[model samples]
Target: MLLAAAVCPHPPLLVPALTGAQDGPPTGPAAEAATAAADLRATCLAAVRDLLATAGPDADVVVVGTGPTPGSAAPDAVGSLSGYGADVTLGLARVTDVPPTGLPSLPLSITIGLWLLREAGYDGPARARVVTQHATPAECADLGARLAAFPALTVLLVMGDGSARRDEKAPGALDERALPFDTAAAEALADADTAALAALDPDLAHDLLATGRAPWQILAGAVEADGRPWKSELRSSDAPYGVGYLVAVWTPA
Candidate 1:
């Protein structure tokens, strides 16, 4: 069976209560919005998962959904990503939207959140189906709870900058709210060489602590910026293993 978790920004996806008479379609706005949304989802998901693989190796990799509507299974869709030993789904709902007097409604931020998940090699399928159905907080929470209870569930990786408290203990869960990306680790990678990072990739090492919940390996590769190699040696301050960061280097044999 597949274990899943739910993570969303507080509040929730806000659809304008009042459908006002609007001007003509904002083509430029729509196009720009779509592009920006895609980029953000990709980047944020990557950063988050990258940090996780480096820091939280025991976590079961997952897919971060995008858009207001949760994802549903498709007949043509390939089953699960058995390679990583985990499954994931994502929704583009703005669960973190604050009201008029609350925090700014940044629906686009979901893009970043989803992106971070992808960057870390967490290419899982989407099981969420609320993005199109307009899910309520209770409904979303209920689904999340079920996922957390899943036997294979190990962690509920939430994005945004907030917190979540899952009551059940069967599948120990974790909620990593809006934490800053580990820029120091990236910088360290920039300064380190591949020789020192071989073990950083899970495939190269077998001693990573395992809780038997979501056990997987991280494959390390050399750093590259703009198609060029970004080389450096990762040090203690830069790469804190078993914390919330992992830094590894890889080279062609």
Candidate 2:
């Protein structure tokens, strides 16, 4: 099951290249990208591993997601973390086709969600997942119900552009919200393109997921980095571009 969603393009692109169609060993840009993702993955893994290392071994940390340089998908295990073993499952796969920058993209931010899930010991795989650039209110509601199934302590981590929006609408369900945003300069670079994604603002990003009134409502409101009033709340061809957003965690009170 997907515990968190990430918006970064680096991981999705790099993972496939590192574990390419006949991989002996990952090398070149793909290898570099894989290493970078692994490093981040390790950071997230250690957060849980530290809690489990002394806590005990039933320490089930499942990082479920498509392929890349880990689990059964990779030619060989990339490298082991100090405290955890990752389980790469098939359901975590990304929609095939549309290579980003010549590299296959996997929802790499899923790793963070997996780490949080492992820390809480809610290890069941998801029956179905909604993977997209953004999810609608209906989608968030459906996901919330699916996540509520695990009676055990569970941490719902959301990664990506619309995380904050989703959680604000339903804070009682999600546990955490995270996004790996580009720094100020990086955001500035996006502005130059006039691209939808390029408008994101680094500073406006929320450090943690904000609570949502209704898990799905979070996906409804629109925002702009400049604090400019929304030109139109109603869906239209000309809404002001949104740059930067709030990611959040929702849990039952």
Candidate 3:
């Protein structure tokens, strides 16, 4: 059964420790972005707490995000940002201390999601699903439905970001369609609009380099699967670094 959910962005910088608070004070090239990210991080953390609160205690947690591979990670799967210049490593749950068996490590998106989970003081065991960026809308929807079918009460911590090409500084560079696309996404997330999410154009998303497409669709599918009335608050919506980072908390109405 599905309980509630929190949606967030998966940028490595969300972990302040990564960039020494990600650009330090508001007086450098990334000044404005730094300030925005700090605010957004606060909102995201709060939203995460709200999700946990809505689910109550002893609820099953499922962490969902976009990644290069599409499937469940080993419960003991490891994640690291050492390659990203942060000398830290994290696990899906507790550190197994053993070598990885199949998957090398949890994908970057899932790894970051786990970091947010830890920051929110959620130290429970969690299942993770990494949807491929190229997955079709129907595929993500199927996965979402399956995720909500777990016997125990379940909560979702969905990780993703909207268009990354909002401006010239964006990774995908400027795209006229980025703003409207992200605006629509932000509105949908704020209102828990599943139909709008399911209708997101993958081709346009791919062109704008929006990695959140699959993960957001999964969220919509999960809500649809639950078929329960839910209300939501869009905690934050901003493209601090030309990447749309949204934070929202959804509770059963």
Against the true structure, what is each candidate's TM-score?
A: 0.28, 0.29, 0.92
Top candidate, metric TM-score:
3
Error of 1 at 245 (Å): 22
Ranking under TM-score, best-scoring first? Answer: 3, 2, 1
Tens digits of per-residue lDDT for model 2 on 192-223?
A: 21123333332233332221112222111111
lDDT of 2 at 189: 23
Better of 1 and 3 by lDDT: 3
Worst 10 residues of 1 by lDDT: 210-219
Q: Candidate 3 lDDT, tens digit per residue, 1-253? A: 9989999898887778765774446566666666776787788888888888877778988889888777998888878887888866777774345533434378888888888877888877778999888889999889889887888999999998899998898888899999999999989988999999999998998998898899989999989998898788987778878888888888888
Candidate 3 has what TM-score? 0.92
Q: What is the lDDT of residue 19 in candidate 1?
A: 14
What shift in Å separates residue 206 of candidate 3 from its native position after superposition? Answer: 0.9
Tens-digit lDDT string for candidate 1 (1-253): 1222223221111111111113333365465534433333333344345445543444443332323435442312222211222322233232223311222222232332343444445544322222222233233434544443445424333332111111122122332220122232233334543223222322111122111101101011202111234332322111111123222222221
